[model samples]
Target: MDRDEAEIVALLRESVRQQRMWLMVVVGGAVVAGVAAVVLLPGARLGAPLALAGVGVFLGVLITAPQRKLLAQLGLSRERAIELLSRADIAGRTPEQLRERQAQRRTMWRVVTAVTTVIAVIAIGYVVSQAGNRVDDNVPGSGPTALFGWALFASAVAGITAIVGFVQLSTFASLDRAMSAEGDEIAS
Candidate 1:
């Protein structure tokens, strides 16, 4: 195969691998958060910031490595990837069409973000409103305050991941199909 097609194949492989990694991050983060909520279950005031910062940092690490790999494999930086894919997309021919396609692709994630926002608002509200429940140290999960705080935390992590992953999935996950070149095309 030609260099370009070979590079595309490498990109396809990397994309699949990175998608799986993010999927694992989502599922695994859920499990970890569930356990932490049950075990430590920090109070509302404490959990909110910790959860936000902790999850944010975790996802940052999860996202950073793949770029290096993508660059190494396809010699394509993130901007180049976006540019190539956008150029190849039919709707990308016009500004309006490109915006429409972007909106269509982002619709699911936008819904997810909205739902998660509502959940977080409600969770933080309930947790804060039950401000006195933190001292119920005798029983586990009895503190609705802490439970909701942890729930919000977990939701925040998963929500951010979903939004980012969905966008990346819509773009990068389709690499093979997007840049596919077969037999004579590759040879040429």
Candidate 2:
């Protein structure tokens, strides 16, 4: 109803939009690379990890670079965070408030990380178990299938690491952008 509420909505919407863009980039890149690798390198055995990991790194850079640029343009300095909160519906938060917010965020990240780790472990176990079956059964060129299985496992790990790494590094990325802006200001 108020101007502050409208600003909050706009900021939140922009945040969601950015997240969607990042996801689309990551998912689209991954799918295309995966299909291309499988098609172009059939029986190559190493295609999965190579293609997926490369895509992961590329997507990470693409997302982070734009995020950093946006943070700089938004002037997301510590002072600005405090300033924005000052009129947004309540008085500005104190240092303790900021610390509490960070602690809560860290807790949330820990929970998510723990869950993802469990899933990854289960996935790795499944892949390894399946790979072992070839050896147990002593099938010829089981070698290639086993190798391909490992490649799939590695690809999964790489993709998971990329997404989680992006989430964890976000704060530092914003800080770096803010600091860069400050340095530019000082120089000019």
Candidate 3:
């Protein structure tokens, strides 16, 4: 194979490896968190989301693993392999397509992050307003303290979601810009 083909193969292998590693880390962390929540909270609902997240990650990894393996085992031509990878949603996306997808995703995430941030702020305000009443509220899950705890938890979760959304938005925006620049360079 030519140097370019060799480079593409290397990149594809590295991409698959990195993706696998990242999925493993995310799944492991989610499982640990879910188990801890189940053990600590018992009947509480905190573990549901974590369990769901872990399942989703596991499913994604499983769905992509076969494609990566087939690509390696097929020994197809480079272009054909790349096209197959693209069909599998693995790699070989044109810069224009990538840029467009990134722009759309960033726009959607921007709106979502904004809404979540606003909700988090409102929850925070409610928590602050109810803080004074928490002094005498000593019930398990049915009083001012319980309300305060739920509100605080909601605020924390929403805030973290907003932060993660913002980070994803920024990443997509940056990727869009980079792809645009790469397209421009290719065109020139």
lDDT of 2 by residue, 1-188 (tens): 23454574356446547867888977877667666766787666554457756867877776666545644656565455445545552346664565566567666766666666665666676666666553433555555453455455554765497468458846755755765686689779
Ranking by lDDT: 3, 1, 2
Q: Estimate every model's Cα lDDT from 0 to 1.
A: 0.62, 0.61, 0.69
Query: By TM-score, who's the top model here?
Result: 1
* Per-model TM-score versus the true fold: 0.50, 0.44, 0.48
Candidate 1 local accuracy as lDDT?
A: 0.62
Error of 1 at 67 (Å): 3.9
Where in model 3 is the C-alpha error above 4 Å? 1-94, 137-146
Q: How big is the RMSD of model 2?
A: 10.7
Query: Model 2 segments beyond 4 Å from truth?
Result: 1-12, 47-55, 78-122, 130-140, 146-188
On a 0 to 1 TM-score scale, where does candidate 1 land against the true structure?
A: 0.50
Worst 10 residues of 2 by lDDT: 1-10
Candidate 3 structure quality by residue, lDDT tens digits, 67-179? 56655665555578667456555356665566677667778888989999998999999988876654333555444443455577679888999999988876875766777
Ranking by TM-score: 1, 3, 2
Instruction: Count clashing pairs, candidate 3.
Output: 0
- Give stretches of model 1 more than 4 Å off: 9-17, 36-63, 91-103, 132-146, 152-188
